[model samples]
Target chain A: MGNVGNVWAVVAIALVAVATFSLGYRGSRHASTTQDFLVARRTVRSRRNAAAVSGEYLSAASFLGVAGLVLKDGVDALWYPIGFTAGYLALMLFVAAPLRRSGAYTLPDFVEARLSSRPLRRVSTAFVLVIGVLYLVPQMQGAGLTLGMVLHTPGWVGALLVAVIVVVNVFGGGMRAITVVQAFQYWLKLFAISTPVFVMCAVFIGSGGTHGGESRGLAEPLPPTFSAPTSIDVTTPVTLRVVEPVWLSAEGRVDGGSARGPVFWGPGTHEVDADTKLMFPGGAPVPSVAGTPSTNAEWLTPTGGGTSDLWTTYSLIFALFLGTMGLPHVLVRFYTNRDGKSARRTTLHVLLLLGLFYLFPMIMGLLSRLYVPELLVTGKTDAAVLALPGKFLSGTLGEILGAVTAAGAFAAFLSTSSGLLVSVAGVLSTDILKGRVRDFRYAAALAGAVPVVIAVFVRPNDISMSIGMTFAVAASTFCPVLVLGIWWRKLTPAGAGVGMTTGGLCVLGALVATTVSGYTGNWAPWYLQQPALITVPIAFFTMILVSKATQRSVPADVNRFRLRMHAPDPLGFIRDRDVARFGTAEERARLAEGRHRR
Target chain B: MTTTEQKPDWEEVQASPDFVLLRRRLRRFVFPMAGLFLVWYLLYVLLADYAPGFMSTRLFGNINIGLVFGLLQFVSTFVITMLYVRHANKNLDPVAEKIRNEVESRGEEK
Candidate 1:
């Protein structure tokens, strides 16, 4: 809220961008060949690759959105970070090592190699672009939200700024650039996010603020009480469900009446017009948005009273648990490993890094409910983490801490957006532009530009929920293709193509239906809200049954490719063809024999 | 073609006892491990969704059954990772490297 702090945050963000560019440029010095641009020549060490993976994975959804969800919804929302981190576990178990052994630079490359079909590659490419762009929009919108909060600028300004920075970084070095920059960002983000929490925690203790055991004002049987006199500024029109009558001072219209003085809101849903300032005296139960849980008990439970919580919870779990393997950006990073063994190792480290970083957001989320209760009314709960330090810690220190969080949030947007752009660009250049570096630059521009423009126009209310829907789409489509394609040697190209199309269309249709219906209660089937539950099984069944029915269409060399994918490098069953490209004739012969198994 | 050339057919190599053994070892570990983990995870998810009161059964001041179960997911992942790595190193890697040496030496001689 301080102009000086906002100016400092802007300056810090610019410095981080410049630093990222320099780091990327340095990494790009090794990027003379396409291999360098594509998979960093598969030279990054496991630990560094793990850090980069963690950096890219902890996007706007994890950084700010998780905390906001927790603050607003209570413990039920903690499942998000858990599912997000654990998805890598599912990845490690099923996809990670084998995918690296597949020796493909991109998802489409893997699809083409495995299925041995150009048309299948084209289909895979379309899905890659869809998932990448869908994932990218949320990061851009999150950047806009952060800028709007920190600097009081138009949201598009920050979104455009992030897009330009990502495009520049990718244009400079592609995957090589993103690797070093992202690894560095992981530490920078960890430091930026955790420091304020630690400082504020100490400050909280020093000020005799006991941790935990405090009543959650909303969860109690009675209505939530404000710990102190609070002023809530309604930025958007809201219908507040009041439990107890409270006399509050209002400057704008309340329930269609322009009130300049004290007005009483009875026990019912009251429409508070936009731009209204409602001041509630201390100990009065805080009114909440209609249909959301207004008590602490409701907030803690899974069936906490919105859209059939059972269906929503299971659907979300199915999507996230299976979806991580399908995220193109995440899958692309695994290719940076030198071998299957390292890829497995890197994923193990990612699990640890993600677990550690998530703890801070959980703490911050709980802190928000205690310190920033007014966020519930403003519906800007996404800003909970950014606003917490300022709410609790006063003076110069608090402003600087807020700036730190702002910088971390910007880092989140930059690292994730850059990773998504690079993956998308990789697909575009390799599939459409013949894997040329110059083409990659053009692809980067197209990849980054589309999302930024959409983010400017179409604003999703909850950042994490939008990301969840993207996960649902990804889970339905790629998860089946990758899992069955890797494990089930019976899978045919037609089966994969049909299954993917079916899953993708079903999820897309559900998404459009849900959007068109406009969040009305029970308008769409609950499965439509979380389509993975229905679509994932459909994908698997379609692939299995069709592949069974068309066994004659199976590739003749399925067993050879299967050996190449499953066998470790020590078995010499799989080799990096890129490395063999520059080798002598005999060396190339060895690599070919390794693959062809002469 | 060299008289001593010994280029084995991919079909033979795949059906060879060594390859079969390798595939079996991998399947023996991955299938059961993946199944157990998935079941454990989904059970927690089901309980969280359907049995809210049970999940909310507090253990400590505010720490509840659900929180513990959620935290266990992270712990189980790390544990499984360690077990799989150890399993690969102990059971899978030696035979795999032996097969590689046999194939490469025979190919070079040819």
Candidate 2:
């Protein structure tokens, strides 16, 4: 099982790597100017740009994370994909054309131009860097997880390999090549997921498939518990092993109360004395295992409702939908188009491509629930898609499916890592390093290196949770800035500065608390876990209030900037006749007078 | 006689036929598409939030109504784009060419 099919998978993965690298190299030929490197010369057509956006946006999180969540939470988890796609819809309607029309390379650039202040630009840039780095962590972690699971390599080695490839491709081709690679990966990923799922479904139906039915046998319900294994030292490799399953029934209380009921221990169950629980993995309390014989379940099955569950559910929706608009990497892609019209069109295309790509992962997640539930108990749920083919299908068919999944995983890692590196590099080249073209090349390398180092030092436990945290942070900080900066004319520099700092610091503080608190405790833990439900609205309100308080000091050119943003281009639909009706003529005449006086 | 000479007529500066057609074509296509897309996207968000049962009902084995609704988000986007391209090609593009010709002709007239 280990090497038999894995060899084919590796060959397939390498082929994808070669294809992506070639596409990137070809893109490099077109990238002679700095603008070409940064924004694809603003010539990207809507359809291709949409594909590229979907490719990069899908990430390992969408590829593995949503499926994993659906497996854990049932139908409720579909909201993640819904929210994610909807965010783009929000962007298409409100932000896309306006953002592109703003003619800025990044969010910070928009801020500076809008507010006409360097300090505001600096503040926004810092927020972008923070969000970019936080976002990069999950992508790096996902790469490690995917590589380790598929290729059976050490996680760090996998992470490093991906980092190197991303750095090289990004440095060589910049945005132009990245666009091609990402667009190709979107379709590659589509084929990878769709092909296997379709084939699997056909096979399942052919084998006299029937939907799952209610369990009739008497089996004790398994209590959810987390324990670290004692045998695996810090240096020792972590691998999955089957222990005898344990089943415990609480007949009565222990220590002071009633007598407890009898418990059964069976295959695949693990047990330890209550006091010896600390000796279990991570020095955490291990729950007494009750052996239960249950049919293997699909990860996508929805469990019945609970009270505390709804908050986490809503928080997930809010974070994914609202937070999407602020992702530095995602937003930067919209800027690659030639004009606002193209940007709008590209966003529309992205919605379609993303919607199509999402279906396969959801299918895979549900299928794993039915057939390959063993992986969930083993804590390697991320590999459910990769592991499914070998379990249900075999021979050449299984091997080919395995190979395709591996290739898609590699594509996922590379496309996402490239998008992150591009954002980081943009920040460094334009904002932090403030270097020229030659310096940008060096800055790009450094940008890639910093994240790899971060990836090495900190390994997140849950890839989905880590990505969610990044989203929370982005929503809290940049979401406010973009929303307010676009719609609110009174958003003064001071207000933006305060809102960004406050929101960024608050989200960062919550992240630090979540990390230090070790995801435990009572109310504080929940708040730290999902801060966006509160933090986003607070940031929005704070920006509005602060801007109003400082309205007297608002820049005089704010109206002019707004007009430029909302005004149709000369070639666009708004002609002199329309302008006259819309009062744009008066505004333009005033602008002309002001320019004449100047 | 020289003192009584009328001021040169600015209206006599001939307008190019191409420029007028280009402006007219742009007015017909770009604005309508932009407006249509805006409505389509807003409708998607509202449907996703409120229509949970519709989204969840299965269309195929495990493929549900909600999934189709989500996928339409993409479909509508492509559909709008195709519409935009078709409109631009048939309506706006010729007008733009006309506008270009008019601008060039005006330059010659001057």
Candidate 3:
């Protein structure tokens, strides 16, 4: 409805990109060596590292998709943001310090170093690629959506632009550059998202917040109504389920097919084609994207005494809570901290920062349910954040706020993909390819290219739900391996290899089965779709049992490895082979005796 | 060969009184704190999913039990971080740093 915002959005986005590359180039200028490119010795202070982590972690999912989910899915959607922030808590408690102490830069390196198996390293690298690609797809798609909305170029333009910028930046500075850009993006994203909510809330409060211009509560049993006469533009063909028939005029393809003239719709399902615009009167009950709850009662309550939501909810909780530690980028960021103590503290600060950030999305989501109820018509709730500001403010100020959200959403795509590509490149260069400078650039190029292709071809799902699936896979696979490797000494390389494959394969198979079967119903045994409840335990059990069976295959240095990992960093008991030649005669003698016995 | 001569007696250190005490104290904090938080979180999740009526009961200003439960998850995380940091600073860090210094000094007596 508001075309005035596009200019502001374009300017804001250009500013973000310029800042990203300028800051990115500064790091690349200093990073000549592969070591510096991949894991720079720049041990950022805890506060800054925490900010960068927050920046990288807050992708399209948190900025745009969370509120969208709120508009479409109702109160059940709040769990995602809560679980996302809480995932860091679990990470801090179980994995953060020990993982940082392990001193292996990437997941594959950590697995290979911990288990002493090259094959296991290969397995880890494969999973890294899968999770990396799975995670990146949504980022690219969201970029495409935001750019398409702002620039009116094809959606692929945004995805390609993000990919190209990320690849170029990675080739220039790699990990070192990414950390600075992400930290900057984190603050920018917070400002872009929060300022609109604050402005909207003042408007709502000043105008005496209520329903139907009366004092009706937010949770009252009524369908959301338009605050004003609204027009919904369907960019993709959407089958909207209208509850109460209203006089609506469409300018493009309606059920009658093509009509440059206006067409009317009745109180039933109707197919509106791409590029169609429908104008409705003020106070009309908003039509919903087919299959979404339209009333406040249905929306506010999560489930209707069903076992399906029960299964999905628990599995979702499991995935989101346990999955953060498994993300390669999240763990890699921990290495930027000076030591385990700082790593723990950095994670703690991330919790505080993330908690503050997640609160705004809830407000934005609630605001959208009232002001932008037409978003439910097209099922593109992801655009809810972008549309709400323009709806509320409706002038230069509205356009500016809309631009702020657009810039933030764009920043989300750039910072996350950049951070993710570094992890992908790190794995590819160090493990899959040679750890050469040239290979690192190739890895970065490959990393950016594949995700963009996928993003271009595939229709974007709800950004956060796709992310939730990726988290489920990560939880089923690496969460087990990392937790077991850190706490349980009996975890053999064979067990890890088998267990990770088992967990990863279950999720992959389930993802395929559900997708192929096209099972959308809540009762469709989504066990195979979101398998954390069943698969995580199975993953842990398989590892322990397999490790027990393969007891003889355990590393000879396993005990000393525990000592190195658990002992403070100041102790020279580090896992690095290079940190030798300083042993006392007594220590040297004991080492020789142990070797002789072996 | 000097290749095998560099490592200290790790099993011996792992068995030492100080290292044992450090590991014990760390595990003592780690296991229970992790378990407590996870259970609290899971209970909240279960109530949200299964007991919807109870969770949706209005408390104040449109704030329901479910909403409060969700927010409490954030609050609990805050408390956990502060408590863990304080506990580690008071209990675990000095011990770990002390052991690191001890091991390094032992090696320095070449």
| DockQ per candidate, 2 decimals | 0.40, 0.07, 0.48
lDDT for model 1: 0.81
lDDT of 1 by residue, A1-598 (tens): 3222676677778878888999999988877777788788788999999999999999999999999998787777877887898788778878888788877777887787788888999999999999999899989999988888888889898899999999998988989889999999999899888999999888777866743333243345565566667788787888888877888899998888898999988898898898999998876677787766666666655543334676677678778988999999999899889887888889889988998999899889878877777778777788888888877676778778888898899999999999999999988987788667788899999999999898998746678988888998888888998999888889999999999999999888988888767645348766677788888899888888888888888988787677777765744334564555434567666655444422
Candidate 2 has what TM-score? 0.74
**Which has the greatest TM-score?**
1
Model 3 backbone overlap count: 1
lDDT of candidate 1 over B4-103, digit per residue (tens): 2445456766777887898789888887987887678668767876677898887866677877887787788788888888887788877776666766
Tens-digit lDDT track of model 3 for A135-154: 99999989988887787778
State the lDDT of candidate 2 residue by residue for B11-106, as single tens digits: 221133443354445446544754665455445444444554454455665455544654555566556556655664576545554543443354
Pairs with backbone N, CA or C atoms under 3 Å apart (clashes), candidate 3: A571-B100
TM-score for chain B in model 2: 0.64
A296: Cα error in model 1, Å: 2.5
CAPRI accuracy category, model 1: acceptable
lDDT of 3 at A538: 79
User: lDDT at A552 for candidate 1?
Assistant: 88
Cα shift from native, residue A473, model 1 (Å) = 1.8
How much is A97 displaced in model 1, in angstroms? 1.3
